[model samples]
Target: MIKVYKSDKAPEKLAEAGYTCDEVKQAILNDQKDKCYLCERKVTTDYQVEHIVSRTNNKEKVNEWENLFLACNYCNDRKKHYYDDIPLPNQLEFENVISQTINLKTQKADFRISKINPQLAKLKELLDKLFNGKGICRNLMENRFWNDFMSVYRNFLRRVAAYKIDPTEENKQLVIEELSIEQSALGFKYAFLNKDAELWSEFQDYCKWNK
Candidate 1:
């Protein structure tokens, strides 16, 4: 996950028609770059207006702008109301607080907490489950999740490899663009880049973390 900046002023239609209205969804899609906030997957039609603090848990904030986010069905259904305390992407710089890496040998995602707090702990728990499955059925779903992640990751890796081979300014810019905040699976790409000290130093300054 990455830090997403949302407009504090709620869309007018959100106050009129409700959270599911096109105005509210379009606002969220624009803020989140049409990607699932939790999974970081690029989504078009398959997206939902998710609540940071679920509607069932906090009805008062049901239509609040700060409480709303964009998510894919896979993450929305699995997240439910269970992780209400997880840090909000709009509120925190998740890239600085949490780390997610794919274990090449196992072909699974692993999470590590870079900072500790009650809320951050909950964030870790939620991310762990979202990226790495717990049970049988969820494991099957997670396989597809991992595949989607790898699809973007591999493309990013290819660009990085090209930059490494040529060391040209243009190729370096390509790698930098791929890691921008608006790109899909930014957390994964950032984590992978962190593995290479030289490249990390070269591109770290160019990476956009927050809006």
Candidate 2:
């Protein structure tokens, strides 16, 4: 998952109508670029304004914008307050210490760590399960998740390939746009780059965290 930043000043409607209001949801969708914060998948109708720390564990932070995030239904249900201590994406950028790779043939995600820590480990486990399911529930949903991620990922790769073959200004611009931080399925996009040293060398600068 990529790091996300929320506006310092909460939306005015948040105080008037609370977090469930359309204004608040739109604000979150704007900040998150209409993608799930955990999975980095583009979300439209299935988006949920999720609480990073569950309400059951920390009720006080429920209405706070910093604690709010955008999530797809599957990721939200799957997470379900399991990791109360998992670091916030806004606070800790997962891409800094964690490296994600995928097996093209098998479509299985592999996450590598540059450093070891409890929070990072939990984040890894969370991502592992989200991308690669476990048990009946997750296995049932895994295909949908992978399909959604791969759709964007394949298109991104195609853009890269086109740029590589043509090396024209238009093709290069397309690749650059596809690799924008606001694009969906960025975790997989970045993983693809990290897997190919040559591509990574050419495109690494474009794969930047949102400031």
Candidate 3:
């Protein structure tokens, strides 16, 4: 998940009126880069305009642009009217507070708090509820992770093959660059794979060289 700044084009009164305008929706999509605030999943459809503070908890901020966010239906449903002291992405530095690791064997992403801050802990708890809690949310997330992981893995394998067949300096460099890009695209959730010394030695070597 990432912190998003509200755009100037976002309608301030749209949420107060109990409705989201097209302009507001567009601004939200732009701010969030079409990804869900919690899971960082790319939201193409079945996305919802979420209120940072539930409308049930605070009607006054219902239409406030700063209180708005983008979320997936599964998250929205699981989080329904449950707002209380939850940490909000817009209000916090998400990347600094938490880190995620992906387990290739289980195809599950595990989130860990980077520090012992109270607010960060709360955010972790909320994430656990939405992602690690009961029901099929974890299963759904695992499936999505597998799909994304394989997509990138396939590209990585292809690049590796090209470099192996030629063993040229240029091919080697190209493979390293491709791996870096893939690592970044995987973001916090899946980038943990880069830390696997045995599996990602080549990529890790490139990272160290580049650093």
Candidate 4:
């Protein structure tokens, strides 16, 4: 049966730690290795949380923890206000740093997140990808395509310097240069903010593939 966490006295702290009914079910399976709590079956089938109490009888009481239980697909389906289920008390860790973050500058609304507790060493390994990765920098650099496109293009630029690919052309036209998906997506065809990026990107694409 499912339990709803609800009460007039129910603090925001409880609701804050609480996930939706769907999340509670996932937490059980994640924590329990997908075994039926009662029958202890290696249930290969989908399962649901059974609500001991019907939620339609008390919609306001939908998130109360006492009203719910882990249920196999065969046992719990559409019985009622099945939504009030909360994950176990130990399962709901409210103060861990990784659970959620606030993006106060950009959004008027608060954003919440959930995750397995990350290991410090494992988390450190990701710092390079986070701080040094091109995807992270692209936004910070005002939506410019960073490393991937440039690496290929840099090679092309080297080739261009070696030989005059444009024997017929006298002067390079800024209006016409090369671009990649990243630049095109940003709609900076004119390269108004970045003529140099356009030049290097265009020249590199030309040198690499033009021949």
Between candidates 1 and 3, the one scoring higher on TM-score is 1
Writing each residue's lDDT as its tens digit, candidate 1 over 5-52 gives 788788999888999888889999998888898888889798888988
Off by over 4 Å in 1: 136-138
Give each prediction's root-mean-square deviation over alpha carbons.
1.7, 2.0, 5.8, 21.0
Cα lDDT tens digits, model 4, 180-210, are: 2111111112222223563445454432210
- TM-score per candidate, in order? 0.93, 0.90, 0.66, 0.26
Give each model's whole-structure lDDT. Answer: 0.83, 0.82, 0.62, 0.35
Backbone N/Cα/C clashes per model: 0, 0, 2, 23
Error of 2 at 47 (Å): 1.0
* CA shift of 159, model 2, Å: 2.5
| Least accurate 10 contiguous residues by lDDT in model 3 | 181-190
Off by over 4 Å in 2: 136-138, 195-197
lDDT tens per residue, model 2, 74-188 = 8888887886677887886667667877788977888876787888888888888888897534465698888878787778878888887888889988988987877876766
- For model 3, how does the per-residue alpha-carbon lDDT over 1-211 read when each residue is reduced to its tens digit? 5454556555664645444677778778777777677766667777899987888888887777667888877677777776545676676556445675555676555668877777667667766665455555556664564476457555755766786678788887866675442243333523443455543655554433111
Please report the candidate that would top TM-score against the real structure. 1
TM-score, model 2 to reference: 0.90
Q: How much is 199 displaced in model 3, in angstroms? A: 13
